[model samples]
Target: MQFTIAEIWEHTGLFARMIIFALGAMSIASLVVMAERMLVYRKSRSESRDFAARMGAILAKDDLDAAANTRPDKNVGHLGRVINSGLTAYRVSSSSKDVAVESVARALERQAQREVQSLKRGLGVLATVGSTAPFVGLLGTTMGIVNAFNLMAAAGSGGLGTISSGIAEALITTAFGLLVAIPAVMAYNFLQGWVDARSVDISESSNEFLDMVARHFGGSHS
Candidate 1:
């Protein structure tokens, strides 16, 4: 019997329907996380580049105050935050050059950790959903096969139509699962690359800041 879309929906088994619903929810969650993370990474990358340029010039002038003041107000980009943290520690230990270096080093390390964690926010969800979605789809497919067999057994003389309808309905869940998972996986990979690049930028900025601080204090302490 040929079935219209509405009839197909009406005949969809409860298990298949539930699996489809779950896949839809996962798709929504992945999309939300992907959008949020993209914005955050973009902001961090843009602001950090600007902050680095400004701070480089400030340090060139031997102006520590100017470097500290280079902290951007719009968004505390990774570079600004790391520099601020190290500078704060350096100022607190200004009495001794060695102590100041040690303090800044520790502060930068802690701040870097926090920055990495921030960059990774929402990534776990994307990864989890991506990795599990295909399996979830497979499970739905298996359930559909089971359902098809059961329907066939119940309708011994009904020919192929009895099992074919159930099989067809079940396959839809597998397709839906793949649709949800593919984009999620792609987004996760793209975002992960951005996070890694940003992390490198933050690390380089930290090292640059430390070197500047050492040079500025080395003259006085010598």
Candidate 2:
């Protein structure tokens, strides 16, 4: 009747055991995603800051050609990509100022979308695991309670001990499910917030780059 881990597991039914295993897998998968996402975000942030500093110097002098040709690593991530896209468009566009500005604007917009999508990669897995893990755990709990009732009936006893094992088995799964789900949901929320913040940053940076392009091209054309 006592809730001992080993004893409870030993008495756990086959269906409950399977549910535990499934929960275990979900836990592992969510942890992996969390780790990978954190690592990627950290790396991208570092590389992007460095890239911005370097690009800032080049862009300060209004050297579009130099900025376009500056090849930073792929790790430079979103900001670098957006700027590079704009520069490339500017570098190869028609001589018409309006055409060049339009081309650069389009390129920046396209690259920003692509970068945002890239940042969102693997977030769905976290969302899925967070939302479903508790329900999956509940399935185990339900099965465990059913088994408990069956055990009590087979023993022909009304004592608490007769049904205690089943109840324990049922509750454990729910506990595990919550344990798995809570962190997944929290992590998902935190990561999502970070994404939102970064998205705003990218948008602002893109608009600034666009404004600079428009100013340079507008004056020349006028």
Candidate 3:
């Protein structure tokens, strides 16, 4: 059951390859998540800024349509879409006494929530991968250790050299798994924060827009 470092390397050849492949996959996934989240945050931030400026102009001039169309799709995030929905509803309901502005506002709020959820899509997958990768690595390590022990028992030797290869392979896989997990977890948290912050900004701006509309329509309570 005696093993040398060279034997360990030889025995772990395929396992090393598997670990490398797993690490690569994890890296790619993390990168994709980071890029997608960055794009979403950037678009939302830009849209919110433009919307704020346009809204300011609309408030001063009392031009609802102009404000509604100000940024269009580029500046329109989930919040923008919701605000547009409420504005459209309010305009259409203007002639009907039964249809209230509050009703339109509520509808838009619901739509906004849906958009938020959509934006948050794929986050769960990233979190799961991040949280579980280390455990998976540990599992690999445990298996490797078991195999090393089995080899030692088969060899009927107490020589550490005999099992060193298997142990090394196990350690290598575990390290690889952690390497994958660390970045995934970090990216998930960072993106979550970014999304939350942008969402807050979007909500605040939308609220302001809603209040402006309410005042224009002579609705009580902003």
Candidate 4:
């Protein structure tokens, strides 16, 4: 089947609406993922910095309580929540210091994992959209092309204009799909890295806090 540029443009116009809709959905998802990840990373960085400063002061004064209380919420991100859990356990485990340390540490680890998962939320959806959107657009494009060819055959047109519209529609959808997928994939990867790094930072900071607590308490609750 032959296609003229003008004919292609007309055929693609029909699928343009659907492609626009898909692009809109993909854009919203990507923006949400980007915004949420940025917020989480920013908060985590601030908390980590504040906590580090507080930890420095506590170390300088050798004050366990001060260290424990120092910007407890501000010092840590979601990881702070996990550390707090361990700290709480440590305090309660005064009766069995040995067992308490182990149990509290384990509990904190679990909580940390949960927090990491929370930080990573919505990433999967973004990734899915990115990975599949192109193919979906391709499908639309293929359909448009097929329809154009069929129409050309039916019309027995000598001019390329007969199938140009359908072909154009097909290309447009494919292009739209790619445009949506690229950013989504990039955002998903960037956020995933940020979340992983933040999680590691939280884990390390929590470990330091736990160690300080253990050392001050003579490795076990009295």
Residue lDDT tens for model 4, 146-197: 8778888888884766665566677877887888899888888888888888
Q: How do all the candidates rank in terms of TM-score, highest first?
A: 2, 1, 4, 3
List candidate 3 segments past 4 Å from native.
Answer: 1-9, 13-20, 65-75, 95-98, 219-222
Instruction: Compute the lDDT for candidate 3.
Output: 0.71
Q: Report the C-alpha displacement of residue 99, candidate 4, in angstroms.
A: 0.9
The deviation in Å at residue 200 for candidate 4 is 1.7
Cα error of candidate 4 at position 8, Å:
7.0
- lDDT tens string, model 1, 96-162? 7777888899999999999899889999999988988888878888998898898777777566766
Of candidate 4, the 10-residue stretch with the lowest lDDT total is 66-75
TM-score of 2: 0.95
Clashes of each: 0, 0, 5, 9
lDDT (C-alpha) at residue 70 in model 2: 76
What local lDDT does model 4 show for residue 128? 89
Backbone clash tally (model 4): 9
Candidate 3, pairs of clashing residues: 1-162, 2-162, 3-161, 3-162, 8-165
Per residue, candidate 3 scores C-alpha lDDT tens digits across 79-143 of 56767776666666654333555767676778778777877887876797798778777777887
Clashing pairs in 1: none
TM-score of 4: 0.82
Alpha-carbon shift of residue 197 in model 2 (angstroms): 0.9
Candidate with maximal lDDT: 2
